[model samples]
Target: MKEMTKKIAVLGAGSWGSILASVLVENGNQVMLWTNSEEQAKELNEKHTNEHYIHDYTYPKELITTLDLKEAVTGADFVLFAIPTKVIRPVAQQLLEVLKELSIKPILIHASKGLELGTHKRLSQVITEEIPEEYRSGMVVFSGPSHAEEVANKDITLITAASQNLDNARAVQKIFMNKYLRIYTNTDVIGVEVGGAFKNIIAIGAGILHGLKYGDDAKAALMTRGLAEISRLGVALGADPSTFMGLSGVGDLIVTCTSVHSRNWRCGNQLGEGKKLDDIIQNMGMVIEGINTCKAAYELGNQLNLTLPICHAMYNVLYNDADIQEEIEKLMTRPGKSEIEKYDEC
Candidate 1:
């Protein structure tokens, strides 16, 4: 059977978004990449490169770039969001108006990770709330351990496409899977989202451990306990515990924590080296999602009465200017408990 080509509109022309749009185009799909910057759009259209985000790489010439959201999404079969979590709601609101005006229903998928700052809602929840049911086919979260740089370099990578609707998940899997990239279908949307979002927090901690010149033993312990915190918060929020063992869970946690490509880990490393959070963020020139996510997780943990020590520690370091060494000492000196006394508490 011949594969049918579909039109994909990818919002946000950042590193991940541009790379994903290129992947879609390479898979024989018509892709329209939407960017807020007219300069970016012009450069992408003419030069076929996004130098600011992904340097020394060329995008597919067939991939289209547009400054107008409506123009990009007008006839797209899928509207994939690759923007930051902070801007998702506003962009979705804009999308809602466009979808209404056009009277077109496209499957909405988000490649972004992290919960909303004030509401602590998942990206999926934010999108669902902004875009009415009548304006979209279904919602899907595309996430896993893959990084933009690796994916752009054509490195072998695997990811999960998650949705409540099995058919929708399968459809996304079929669309995105190629030789260089593999896609798995998962129906546990909550688990996938939670795991994806929470892993960034642990990654930052891992970076801090490395920055402090901690040995493998300490880093290993941090990752294990961090996973515990993630799984506990996820389970409390209605995610499947076993999902943490999957690609979106432990898989993502390992990569983000260990990789040099991870912004969160890098941010944490700088904090470990005694740099101020505000200064580090200003220098990095990219959004460090884990910082904001740690804030959300801290507030959420208190509200749910969950003991998220690592998250709280990260929150203190990032927001409250708490001493990193003191926080580490605090975590180590805490009263002990059995490794698996309770499944939920773990």
Candidate 2:
């Protein structure tokens, strides 16, 4: 079957967003890369470079950069949001207005990971609430163990396109699949989103372990237990327990926790090295999603009466200014139980 070209408006000109936009352009899509920064738009339009995010990478010349939300989304077949989770609602609201004004219904997709701050809602839920059903065709989440730096370099990468609507997920999979990038379709949106969001918290813990000079034993243990915590929360929130074992779940956790490219892991490494969170964030110049995710998951766990020790520890360290060593000690001293016991309960 001949592939149909899509007009996609990719909101957010950050690393991941820029890379995905370029990929869409390469795939023969009419891609619009949107950024709030007029200067960034000018640079991308003129130089085909987004230096602040992905350095030394040239974007496809066919990719267009836009500052006008209305201009980007008008007649777009798909609106792919790659912005931070915290700003999802506001952006969705803004997008909603533009969609309404233009009288167009675009399929909404999000590549961002992280739960909403105060509501502890998944990013999909937030977008759904903000964008009325009449104004959109469907919703899909793009996630898995993907890093912008690797994808920018055209390294082999695999990711999932998830939605309750299986057809929509498959559609996304077809649009994104290429020789260097493979896309899988999954119907478990809840599990995929939960897994994708929660893994950042674990990645931070992994980075903390690394910065503290802990051996592989500790790193392995942290990741295992972290998966358990993720499964617990996901199950409580109506996600399939099996999804935690898939690409968006364990796959994402493993990569984010171990990779130096992970913003969350790098932030935790700095924290473990005795740097202040504010200072680390300032230096990093990008969102460290784990810090916010840790807080959201900590609260969500409490509400669900779930014990997320790793998330709780991260929360204390990030929000309470609690000592990292003390937090680790506390986690280590917790009452012992069979590892499978928690999994069984979840």
Candidate 3:
């Protein structure tokens, strides 16, 4: 790897953002962790702990937290979008406003996942639309199975650093890539983007099965069938089926579904156990992407005229006031279909 010194600006002080910032500073990069609250900035820069969001971890001296968007990105060599999916739009707009003076561009990496609900556009599409076209050349997505909780402690993780620019992708791959964190490169941003967003749905389903006290046998079946649904929807959207087998696909789906750390899965577990969405969110104090994603995926399937049976069942349960177990029974009692349908991208 080429010797390098860089400045990293991590937008969003959530668990993922802080963990990523810690990783950046550990790599000897100057990291400015951006937070929305001025109070959070003070806490991060002074006490080194962000109690309001990700508690218990204090940042090192090299890591500085700031609320000034421009100050954070002034000379940054790399930018990571770790904010939740919904806030990405206004946040990117904020970045564009701050970056107007810069003719020279820095590498852009999005660590966030999901599509804009209404337009059904991926985060990469939104980034390309918001940021200057000049910056588009350096855009990449660092996505995969690493959860924020595990990543903060520097546990072994693997991810995809995908870009059309092989050189730029390799640079990102090397920056956070370590013995514990393996980085894979992909030219199919569409595949990586779609896979990451879609997996959360299956994760929610996995959580439901667990919540219902279904044993490993049932959970395994749910995951396998869920992977089939994911590949089907992704391939219909022009992603390569082979990409479905890789880290951003199967690896991510498995982790999110199985891990208690997954918010989406937890949300589904609550629903399965007969709790209200409003109550669940109020208790957790964080957004559950899968709940909203269930709606998005359902609408997108209708638009595409694709038969996402699994998603359809999930949506029916979520929005139509359909009985949850009835939906499950509905799926189980369906007419027998060829087993090969699961593997084929139709």
TM-score of 2: 0.98
- Tens digits of per-residue lDDT, candidate 3, 1-346, equal 8667888889988878888898878877888888888887888888988776666877787899888888889888888899888998899888887777654477889988787889888898888789977753489998899887887777889999988788888988877876677899998888898889888888888888887887898778777877787777787788888987999999999899999889988988888898886788889777787766778888887887777778888888767868878888988988877768743434
Better of 2 and 3 by TM-score: 2
Write one digit per residue (lDDT tens) for candidate 1, span 1-346. 9998999999999989999999999999999999989999999999999998998999999999999999999888999999999999999999999999989999999999899999999999999999989999999999999899999989999999999998988888888889999999998999999999999999999999999999999999999999999999998999999999999999999999999899999998988888888898999998989888899999999999899889998888888888899999999999988888454563
Off by over 4 Å in 1: none
Query: Which candidate order results from sorting by TM-score in descending order?
Result: 1, 2, 3
Summarize candidate 2's per-residue lDDT along 1-346 as a digit string, tens digits.
8777899999999999999999999999999988999999999999999999998999999999999999999789999999998889999999988998999998899999999989889999999999989999999999999999999888999999999998889888877889999999898899999999999999988888888899999999999999998998898888899999999999999999999999999988888788898899899988888888888898888888887888888899989999999999999999877777654363
Query: Candidate 3: global Cα-lDDT?
Result: 0.83
Q: Ten-residue segment with the worst summed lDDT in candidate 1?
A: 337-346
lDDT of each: 0.93, 0.91, 0.83
How many clashing residue pairs appear in each of the predictions shown? Answer: 0, 0, 0
Better of 1 and 3 by TM-score: 1
Clashing pairs in 2: none
Task: Name the candidate that leads on TM-score.
Answer: 1
- Give the better candidate number (1 or 3) by lDDT: 1
